[model samples]
Target: MPSSAGPSIDKITEGGRVTQVGEGQDADESAPPVMTFGAPVAGEILAERYELVEHINNDSAGRLVWRGVDVVLRRPVAVVMRYPGGDSATEMLQAAVAASRVVHPNLVGVYDAIDEAERAYVVREWVDGRSLRELVADGPLDAGRATAVGNAVASALAAVHATGMVHGNVHPGTVMISDDGRVVLADARTDGADSQENDVRAVGGILYHALTGHWPHAEAPLHGATAGHGRAAIPDAVRDANGAAAAPRQVRAGVPAYLDDLTMDLLDDSVAPPSSDVLAAELARLDVPADDDYLDSNGPLRFAAEPGEEPSPLAAAGGRKVAFGIAGLLAVALIGLIIGISTLGGESDDPKTDPVAAPSQSPSASSAPAAPAVRDLKISAARIIDPDSRNRSEVRDAEKVFDGNRDEGWSTETYPTSNFGDFKRGMGVWIDLGEERTIKSVQVNLSAPGASAELLTGTVTGQSNESGDKRVLDEFKKNRIGQPFEEHDGTTMTFNGFDADQKYRYLLFWITELPSNGNGYKVGVQEMTVQGS
Candidate 1:
């Protein structure tokens, strides 16, 4: 299990009812005996399948969270149990059933929801990770990472909303980051008390908490097992005398003005929040290179508006216009428009295909031919390549590098020395662009400086077997595409040595040296993006 900053405590809320469980607390003496009598014991099997292995904690709402095992499936699971279950656990069970219906990569999988006459328990996927609340316990996240988290949460909510369901819970505590760098949302309430709009606004609160380490919505306290035991775990948002929460940039330095504007706009109820999908798209656009001071290459992010609705003034005020109207069109259409104009004059002259029919080109378009589009290439799939490792587990989460998250990533096991403890040569990530694409630059974001890496390209056999992977690895090693980046001093590395005329399908980012991490050494690919059409 991932470690927490303090003693673990969980706050669970259904509808308007809130329950809190603290460490080392006994059941209340004055509470009903039925609530305390049916507490599950370690090794007890429920529904003849889930065996409780450990009592993790309890919530104030008189519910228990147990780390258990699905004896039949031999997989770890989290069993949340409430006593005297018939009527009291209806909302919880209903939420689990609803969440189970809509599957998403960022959502915790719901396995079973069972209700006995005396007690009820809901089984869910056990995450070997910590919550976002724990992550921000120390301090705020950088703009890039916070954007990534917000993007993930928005995406999850978008998935849920698509099914006409509301994930009533969207707070830091419910957002989980696994050991292999998967961001998952867990514990949906699904009670009718919350609306989809509230869920969208909660993402803003999540962004605020991530970037500023402050919970903006006082109505929803930061949920933590250890909260309220002593000093508050997370402080309320800093507000002026006028009662408006301060922007993230004001609370912390280095937060990009555009990100600050987007977050505040979401939290502003007067200015309607964009739909979950729109918010996800906007955040994905902002999840740029960590080293970038601002979004220059990708331009600004614009929140989508209703067909006739005007874009929010907050979005346009900070020079970070939401993706709407001419601005959005220019970013995507300009390249194609310019390309078409250049090719128009080159086409074989025919009276049927007159130059007058062509779209009016920019004044400078006639001066020079347009450049080919060099946008961010979408990675269809990615896998870690540890051809030399004893176990193949290191290759489990290669997608993390391309998951648009700079904070969570695929990391190598720590070694006593920088050179993989002399156990193997090195490891890397292999990315497939689905189809051959015009070669451009590849940007690799590392967790630390001083790592050495090289860029290589090769063709992938359609085979999905080990022999195919080995062949790909061999080709990558033999046909290195660019010069090796040796002992890079910075965390961001861009390999632009690819021949523009050549097309590439499979590319390998091979790391040769590890950066110093504590007394040992390890390296992490926080984010990797290939730039091409």
Candidate 2:
């Protein structure tokens, strides 16, 4: 569970029940104890004053049913366990090891873990909505809704894989609806590693049912027997005299072609499913009502994965060599220009001349002054309009998410809402622009203890080394804090400058204090506009 904010998790005790907690009730006696199995699991009952209620949801492995509390902190949560026969305790432990590593929203939260007594139980955030299996019991989801669900789960999986773990189990039955109006992935550990590859395969299974309303694995559609106003439909994998329901595109006209192809690919085992990274990229590209936001071909730069010596070392080093050479040359020229200016006598008579001379005009100026060189050359003025109007910004707190528009953005403390660790989160962006351009002004909107919004702006230009290309670019934003942004109240941070030209294809902005791990970095954006010289 995200340790970012909200409140602490409720602990478990022996002889607990699921049907007794709620919105406003005493903490000690909320839900009815487990009737099917008497008594709660033994422990200190960390919940200082809450009661247990009835079961809200349960899987074949364990029941995550809800229980109300009898005391103050009256909220609903679930206790998950699959201690029955088939799988051994060791297997469940391994599953926990893998599941505990992933920290993200869409995934369910795993609070407490008891590896003793040959039993393992996970306390997860309780969701009040029905199971997705129940939602599609009558039929699979329409392509539109299916795509939305697929996007959410895919994103969830991407976050899990980022931490080197797999969601071994992914079926309609394991996905759940939250009381908070968000989709939740409920069963990540039930399947284990043998299910890893199938785990990837299951994404397709989910998309299939979501789009067609039929279970490809089942002989006939599970929902076929369900009665509705009209005739029932069959799974996409199966054909009947009436024929399977029209293709997803036929059912819903605007379904993306990639999704249609992805579903069919699941039918064949010979084909390899996409990596979560690749799948995420594709889905991001297929976003709805599409227009051209700059497309980035390279990965992020902050943490560059190294290549083995055997791989073409020369090719990999070529770009860096050229970049280094350019930097060296620029350094030399700056030194030479400063020396020449100190010896020369000519001075500009232009009306616009100031106390400081311009670099282009005064090649012999004694000093170049900290003008363009001081600014992060990573960005240049691809264009500048209305020189008189300048924009300046500085990031004092956390990096914020850019609103689809530029002026408005929000922050997220617990970035990936599923993290098990106490400190983990970040703020990021998916930038859209025609080409690179220098920033002129930077503004950081912050909210600290007693303040609503603290705005700050400055000119710092050492960020020229950041990369924007065919790879991921998780660089410390030129003006962003090295630490992940969290704990601080939500803020809107913007960096602007006009002396440098940004050369990257797209700027997926991310600035946080902790680059090693995600920090509570959630920023929302409103809009960003660029002008031509």
Error at 216, model 2, angstroms: 1.4
> 76-184 in candidate 1: lDDT tens per residue?
9988888878899998899889989987777888999999968898998887766777667767776667777787788889889999889887777778766555667
Q: Give per-residue CA lDDT, model 2, range 1-533, as digits (tens).
A: 12122111111111212121111111224553344333343332424543444434333323333443424545555654444313455555566556666766677665555544423455556655545555565555534356556655666777777776777666666655444435556555544344445656666777777665655654323212322212223334444456443334334322434466666665557876667655545544343221111121122211112344332444344444356567778998999999888746445665455346534556565564554432322222211011111110011111122221234333322222322123322223333334444455433443322112111112321221112221123232333322333434444444443344533333334433321123222233333333322
Q: What are the TM-scores, per candidate, against the unseen true structure?
A: 0.52, 0.41
Best by lDDT: 1
Q: Model 1 TM-score?
A: 0.52
Q: What would you estimate as the lDDT of candidate 1? A: 0.73
**How well does candidate 2 score on lDDT at residue 179?**
41
The 10-residue segment with the lowest total lDDT in model 2: 384-393
Q: Which pairs of residues have clashing backbones in candidate 1?
A: 9-225, 10-225, 19-60, 19-61, 20-60, 21-60, 302-322, 302-323, 303-322
Give stretches of model 2 more than 4 Å off: 1-50, 62-64, 68-74, 82-94, 115-120, 138-140, 179-181, 190-196, 219-237, 240-256, 289-533
